[model samples]
Target: MAEHVLEMKNVTMQFGGVVAVNDLSLEVNKGEIVSLIGPNGAGKTTAFNVVTGVYAPTNGAVYFNGKHIVENYPRGKMKKLYAGTSRGVYTKHIEPTPDVITKLGIARTFQNIRLWKSQTVFTNVLIAKHMRRTSNIFTATFRLNRKEEKKQREETEELLKILGLYEVRDELCTSLPYGLQRRLEIARALATNPSLLLLDEPAAGMNPQETAELTDFIRKIRDDFHLTVFMIEHHMDLVMDISDRIYVLNFGALIAQGTPEEIQKNPKVISAYLGEQE
Candidate 1:
C-alpha cells in the first residue's frame, strides 16, 4: 500500500465574498514528485499557504502524514456566507501557526527568493538549523549547548558541500547569482530536516539553462534526501519533464489530475489554458 505524505480534503478558502480555493482535495504519496500547474491568480499559492498553515481553510481539513494537522468549518458570519459544501462535516476548528508546521517535518521555499540580505550563505543555512536545537534559553545563552551547536554547524557545512555551495559559503547570500540565491533558499529549507518539501514557482524568472539546472537539482534533492516533493510551476516544460503526476487548477478549483500524458491530452485543461473554441 502506498503511504500518503500530505492530503487536503474539501479545503476551501474564502475571504469576504471571494473564494480563493474551492473544495480543493489532493494527495501526495511518499517519494512522488507532483506538480500543480495553473494560470496566474488560480489560487496555486493559496493552496500552498493553506498547507503551510498561512491561512486556515474556511471549510474541510488538511492532513499531514496521516494525522490531521489543521481543520475548520464555517462559524458565525462565515457559516451564513459560506459557499462551499462540507460546512458541518468538521466539528472542530484547528489552526496551527507557520512555525508549528515547519517544525512538523515540512519545509517550503517562497515564490520569490527570500534570503537573509546581510548574512553569509553559511550563516543563513546555519540559522535554519536553530529550530532543531534542543537547548533552552539558559543553556544556549550560557554557551552550555556548545556540543549541540557544533554538531549543527558541522551538518550545515556538509549540506553546503553536498549542494556545491561550499565554495561560496562565506559570501553574502543575496550577493550570489539569481539562480544561486534560489538554490540557497532551498538549502535553507533543507536545513530544517523536513520529510516533505514544497516549492513555489521555482522556475520563475529563469532562462532555459537555469531552469533545466533546477529540474535536475530538484530531482537530485528528492532522491538524495528521501523527500516527497510538491511544487507549483508555470514552466510547462519543467512540469511535463519532471512531474510523476500533474494537477491542473483554474479559477481556484481543480479541473484535472493525472499523469503528464493524460494531462496533455485532457480537453478541459487545453480549454482552460487556451479558452473554449467556438
Candidate 2:
C-alpha cells in the first residue's frame, strides 16, 4: 500500500448555520493524484481551505505527514491585532497561520489566478522560492549569499522548463494566454517544493484541447516531482481521466468515493451531476 501523505478526520466547517463541510474524512497517499468533485457549493473548496489552513474547521482535525498542523504556527501581526493578542492562540487546535502549514511541505493554487499580474512569469515563480530559502532578506537582496541564490535560480529555471513556461519566462504574467497563465500558477506552486499540492479548479477556463493537454501535464508533474496531488476540479473529463481515486461532495458532505469507474456509475453522483434527467 502507498504511504499516506494527508488525512482529514471528521472535518466540519460552519458559516453561522450553514455547514460548508460536514464530517468529511479523506486521505491521499504518496505520489497519488486524487480528485475532489462536486456540484457548486458542495464545500470542495472549503475542504481545500481547511486542509491548507485558509479556514480552521469548526469541528474535527486534519493531519499532514502524520502531524496535526491545523493550529501549529504563530498568528501573524494582523490576526494578533484583530484578536487583541500578540501571543499565538491555537483556535480549536488549528494552526494560527497558513505559513506554518505551508512550511510543513504543502502548497496550493487558488481558484482564481493569484499570480502577480505585474511581474514576469520568472519573477512570480522566483518569489515562491523565497519561502524555502534559508537566507535572510538582507542577504537575498544584496546578493550576499551568492551560492544560495545561484542554487535557487537554477532550481527555478528547471521548474519553469519542466512546466514549459521557460520560453516565456521574461514575459509579464498578465500578457500570457490564459492557459499559459494557469500553467504558470502550477509552476509557481511547484517552486515551493511541496510534498503535497492542492490545485483548485486547474482546468477552469481552458478549451477542450487545452484541458486535455493539461491532463497530461498534471500527470507528468506528479511523476517528475514525486508529489501527492489533491485537486478540486469541475471538469469531469479531466478528473475522470487522471484521478486514481475520486471523492464526490454535495451539500458540503461526501456522497461518494471510489475509483473513476466506480464513481461514474454511482447513482448519487449521477443525481448530483445530471439531476435525475428524464
Candidate 3:
C-alpha cells in the first residue's frame, strides 16, 4: 500500500463557543492529488491552518511523514472549548511552530498570495530555499557560504524554469499578474523541498483560461516532482478534473468523501454544493 503522507486523526478545532472543525479526519497518500471543498464558512481554511500549525487543533493528532507533527488535547482555558470527546482524560499537547512545521517535509500556500511584495520573484523563491540550508549563521555572516548560496540560486532558477516563472524572475513579485503570482506561491512552497504540498484556494481569482492553465501546471508539477498534493478549492471544474479523491465539508463538518464520480453522485455533496432537489 502507498504510504500516507498526511493523516489527521479525529481532529477538532474550536474557538470560544465556535467550532471551526469537528471530529475531522482524512488522509493523503503518496503521489496522489486530493481536495477539500465546501462553502465559504465550512472551515476549509481553518483545517489548513491547523494542519500547517498556525492554530493548534483543540483535540486529536496530526501526522506527516509518519511523524506526530501536531498533537493536541484540552487544557486550562481550552477545556470547555475542545469541541470533541477528548476532555476529562490524560491528553497530550504538542503544537509545533509554523516554521518548525515547514522544515518537517510539508509546505503550504495561503489562500491569499503571500509573496514579499517588495522582493523580486527570484529573491522570494531563494529566501524559501534558505529554510533547508546547512550553513551556520557565522558562515553566512562572513560571506563564507558563497558556494551554498550559488547552489541555492541555481536550484531556484531551475525551479522557476520548470514552473514557467523564469521570464519574470527579476520582476517585483507584486508586479506579476494574479495567476502568475499564485504560481509563484506554489514555487515558493516547493523551495522548501516538501514531500507534501498544501494549497489553499490555488484557483482563487482566476479566469477560466487561467484556471485551465493552472490545472495543467498543477499536474505537470506533480509528475515532475513526484509530490502528493492536497488542496482546498471552490472551483468545481478544477477540483473534479485533477483530484484523485475528494472530501466535501459543510458547516465545518465532513459530508462526504470519495472519488470524483462518487462524490458527484453522493446526494449529500449534491445537496450541499449543487442544491439538488428531488
Candidate 4:
C-alpha cells in the first residue's frame, strides 16, 4: 500500500450562508502530483487555503504524514457542519497555522507572484532557508552561526542552479522575466525542504512555450526532490500533462476525479467546462 502524504476527509468550509468546500475528501500519495481543477468560482483556491491553514474548516479533518493537522471545527451556528459524523474530528491537536504546517513538511506558492521586490533572487530563497535555523539571535549576531549560515547559502545556491536561476542570482526578484519570477517563488518554497508542494495556478499567464517549459520543470522538481505536489490549475494542458490524478470541482463540490484521460471524458467535467450545467 502507498503511504499517503496528505488526506482530506469530509472537509468542508463555510462562511455564514456560503459553503466554500462541501464535504470534499481526497488523498495524495507520496511522490505523486495531484491537481485540483475547476471553472471559476469552483472553490479550488478555497480548498488550497483550507489545506494551508489560511482558513479553518467548518467540519471534517485533514491529515499530513499520517498525523492529524486540522480538526475540531467550532461553530456558533452551523447546521451541516456535523452532518454524517464519523469516529471523531477531535484529537490531540494544535491549531495548524500556515508557518506551523510549513514546518511540518508542507510549503506553498501563491497565485500571485510574492517575491520580495527589493531583494535579489538569491536572498529571496535564502530567507526561506532561515525558517529552520536553530541559532538564537545572540549567536547569530555574534557570528556563532557562521557555519550554519554558510551551509544555508550553499544550499540555496544549489537550489537556484537546479531551478535555472543561478545566473540571475544577484538580480532583483521583480526584475526577472515573468516566468523566471514564478520559478523563483517555487524555489523559495523548495528552500523550506517540504515533502509536499502546493502551487497555485503555476501556469497562469504563460504562453504555450513557457507553459510547456513549466510542465517539464514541475516534473523534474518532483522527481529530483521526491516531492508530492498538490496544485490548483486552470490550464488543462499543463494539468493533464503531468498530473497522476485530477480532481474537478464545481460550485465548491467535487464533481469528478480520475486520471487525466478519465477526467477529460467525464460528462460532469465536460458540462462544467461548457457551462451547460444548471
| Candidate that would win on TM-score | 1
Per-residue alpha-carbon lDDT of model 3 for 1-278, expressed as tens digits? Answer: 87989999888888888888888889999999999999889999999999988999888889897887888887778765556654544267889999999998889999888999999999999999999998998998999999999999999999999899999999999999999999999999999999889999999999999999999999998999999999999999999999999999998888999999999889888788767667
> Model 1: which residue pairs collide?
none
User: Which stretch of 10 consecutive residues in model 2 shows the poorest summed lDDT?
Assistant: 78-87
> Per-residue lDDT of 84-110 in model 4, one digit per residue for the tens?
333245443345789898999999999
Could you tally the backbone clashes for each prediction?
Answer: 0, 5, 0, 0
Displacement of residue 267 (Cα, Å) in model 3 is 1.0
Scored against the true structure, residue 33 in model 1 reaches a CA lDDT of 98
Error of 3 at 126 (Å): 0.6
**What's the ranking of the predictions by TM-score, best on top?**
1, 3, 4, 2
TM-score of predicted structure 4: 0.94
Tens-digit lDDT string for candidate 1 (1-278): 88999999999999988998999999999999999998899999999999999998898899999999999998889978998776678888899999999999999999988888999999999999999989998997899999999999999999999999999999998789999999999999999999999999998999999999999999999999999999999999999999999999999999999999999999999998999968
**Tens-digit lDDT track of model 2 for 1-278:** 76889998777776655667777889999889999999999999999988887887666678888887663222343332232121333345554467877788999999999999899999999999988878886886898888977888888899888789999999999999999999999999888889999999999989999999999999998998988999999999999999999999999888999999999999999999889867
lDDT over C-alpha atoms for residue 93 of model 1:
87
Overlapping backbone residue pairs in candidate 2 total 5
Residue 125, candidate 1: how far off, in angstroms? 0.5
Best by lDDT: 1
Error of 3 at 125 (Å): 0.5
Clashes of 1: 0
